[model samples]
Target chain A: MSVELIILIVVITALIFDFTNGFHDAANAMATCVATGAFKPKMAVLLAAIMNLIGAFLSTNVAKTISGGIVDDQLITPQTVFAALVGAILWNLLTWLFGLPSSSSHAIFGALIGAVLVQAGLIGIHFSTVASKILLPALVAPVVAGVASYLGTKIAYKGKHNLPKESKKRYRNAQRVSSLLVALSHGTSDGQKTMGIITLVLVAGTLQLGGDQMPWWGQAPGTGPHWWVILSAGIAIALGTYSGGWRIMRTMGKGMAEIEPPQGFAAETAGMSCILASSHLGFGLSTTHIVSGAIMGTGLARTPEEVRWNTAKRMLIAWGLTLPAAALVGGLAAWVAHFGSWGFLVVLAVLVIGSVTIKIVSSKNHVSHENVNDSHEVTVLAKAAISSVTETIPNPLAPALPEEIADHPLAASPLRLTGLKPRPKPKVPKKKKTPPKSKKKKQRKAAQQKAAVAKAQEHEAAREKAAKAKAAKEKAAATRAAKAAKAKEVNDA
Target chain B: MPSLIYAIDWMALLLVAAVSIAATVIIAALMSVSNYFFHPPKGEEKASQPRRILGFIFLGLMACVVAFGLYLMIPYFH
Candidate 1:
């Protein structure tokens, strides 16, 4: 195929990746809210989709990073980027197919790296930029998210406990605002990464700015892949969001946390803070990392047992491998593509054929809207079913068991939660090994324990921390009150 | 100086990095999964250290691979 046709094919493939990203990661923004019944599936995605569109206009820094920050677009060709994209897309598809929560950011980065190596060797790598922009955030962003969520959850609990029923209603009701902000923030942050890459392709191919001048369109393209590119990428991601990566959603929404509205709201708010900060700074921090870590952190804060360590570990592995894997495949593809236009055609044909086969096969094995919102227990069972179908689902302990996820029930192209094995169901009961004591005794003991702990800490710092903790307590108490009132009102009538 | 030795070593480093990156990810995933069956009753202390180490290894290997990959890809310009 000609270079023009080659670019077209590559962009389409990128869209395919984006589409997978949409359904695969939709849960990142909407899963908690969806799990909590804050919004119906349709309403949740619709809201997420619209905000994602609006978020496109947020900033162009991430776009710049992709197009210019990661690699020197000038040293390579549009074809090189195309090769990198294919590697990225393939990695995305493979991860999604396996249901591994791999990172698109990493995949793209990897593929770009790979393609650059094959096409032009390694003349234009920026170590400082890579470290400052990518590595630092990769490590810290998630941890920060987790910390913020843990704190957020503590506050949520105290608020639930102490706030008068009337005022606590305000925060619960304001979830709409926070949830939508997350979608908008997610869009603003994620949309720009694609823009940056495409623009990088344009600048590297068109302008001969000897590595010194980073030529950004700074404006939408009037003719080529311009504003339409921005609009399309946003819409693509939004549509992905709308499609709802429900499998990952279940893992995040229910598996990680028994999120009340307060915790969910706080997690979203904290996630928004991270995304907005990163977008403004123009770094390509993984939205997946920030949101999931925050949710897990909040869950951990709620109760240490609440955060599912197994699933979280699986995600960390995916994030770690995504960029390098993409880069590797990208490099391989570039090497393969070196065989003239025929090389590109063969690769393109393979991708088109392979993607179509997956779609057809996946359609047959879908989780469906009816079962999508089934309780977390049912979702785990659904995953268990997929694993049994594909004996490839390894004992998560086996070094390679990460790839056993045959179907991701939550997100689209974003695959994760791969380690599935025979549950030590018997052992699960062993953790609470105590024989069932009287319910009243357990409740009283729990309260007394909480009170005793509260009393022991009288220092001012502890007091302020307790003060923050008190808000979540009140919120939790209010929710309990609402549950009680609803029950009582039924009895009175 | 950006010596010839610097150039060739980076390429070799990339291959080592790739192998390590793949192994580290697979190893980390397995160990965590092993949590359920082998040591089904791990405390926070048990889980946290292995997890941190695994994560640290993954990041370390990835960074090394990227650094070296960039190193090799750099000399193709002139």
Candidate 2:
């Protein structure tokens, strides 16, 4: 396919990845609010969505960092970026399916690194920039947020001792505000990653078309993402946030830690502060890591026992594996996509099929707004399979078959499908007949009564209006008389 | 150990940690202080004049800090 067509496909893929990032990390902004019941799941998601969109307009520093910092733009093509996005999106979907709060930022970084490695070899990847800008910040930002949250939680509790009931109410209100900040900060940081990717694509496309000289539309090689890029990224994330990632929200809000109102406030505040600072510094820090660490820190401060160590460990494992796992997928995708148009077609087909399959599997035990806080383990493929099997089996000791099942055609088949019995329809209750003349009389009476009530209401409104007008006129006359008397007294004096 | 340490940008890392930690702690402290002063214990009279004044001061400071941070996030500001 043509480079323009390929660029279009890459941009669309980048937006898809942005959408996944929004929904996946939504829990970072909203989990505590949902957990503390400060806001309903739907309301929390909506608030985060709005804040994220606003946040996207706040800064392009992080986007500039991603577009021009991590990988050498000169070496990689739009196709390479497309392959990286595929890796990141698939990783995000996989992590979401398992309800693990892995970093979408890391996934994107890893995918880009891997794809670039495959395309232009080791020199195309910038080790120093990656180490300083991405890796170091990822490691330290979370720790700082965690410690701050832990101490913050302790301080919050100390304050709570003075005002138990009132503090709880205050904390809940404060938590809502803090979560909003976190959502906005998330928009500033995470939303820009997609903007950066899209900008890089445009930059790379323009560079390819015009040899060494910079194109007119491109302007200053790497100042920041364009306005349209930022807008699209913002909208994609907002739409994703509105969708609500209940599965991961459940994991973060309740699974890793049993959060209270005060802890939620502290955690969200710390996460928001860290994210804002990092974004301003142009560090593409993971909002997931910062929020997760804060949640764990709060859990430890409140009651170490309350923190689910196993769940925490599992999440840590996911975090550790995210880079390499996404890298592997990205590398493989890059290799496949290197084979021209036919390869792109094959990869697209696989992506569609894979996404549909994951969707189907997720639907078997869906987590949605209604039951997000039920605190049950998500239905895994194995568990779903077992449940399906159990549902099919009939108790052998049962007295007799139901009449409906016995009479069904499939029941007589050699397969003896126990669970395939046709459902029996409910019998409608017979209606009692009424005399037509009485019904007509009642209807007319009801209409006449309605008209009388309307007329009475209008009469009452007119009377009230007249009373208000009379009071106004009386007050105006009294004021006028008082003013004349005052003027006459002044003249006499 | 020195070589490994040299490989990383210690100054940048320290700055990130210090700023993040300080910001987080300050915000949390502000929240704690607000809770203590604004929401007094049950059966007690609402916050006294002095305490209420202090509480408002803390809240105003916190709001300013957050607003500044957000202001810095805008592309134009950078």
lDDT of 2 by residue, A330-442 (tens): 88888899999988877777777877888788887778887787763555564332222213444455456699776664343332443543433357999987769989899
lDDT of 1 at A2: 42
Model 1, stretches more than 4 Å misplaced?
A: A57-67, A159-171, A199-225, A281-284, A360-365, A375-493, B1-78
Model 2, residue B78: C-alpha shift (Å): 5.1
Candidates, DockQ: 0.02, 0.40
What C-alpha RMSD does candidate 2 show over the true interface residues after superposing them? 2.5
**DockQ for candidate 1, C-alpha atoms:** 0.02
**TM-score of each model, in listed order:** 0.61, 0.76
Error of 1 at A263 (Å): 1.2
Off by over 4 Å in 2: A61-68, A159-163, A210-226, A281-284, A382-493, B1-4, B41-45
lDDT tens readout by residue for model 1, A120-169 = 66676654555555555577667766766666666555423433343234
* Per-residue lDDT value at A29 in model 2: 90
Q: Considering the true interface contacts (CA pairs under 8 Å between chains A and B), give the fraction that model 2 also has.
A: 0.62
Cα distance off (Å), candidate 2, residue A33: 0.6
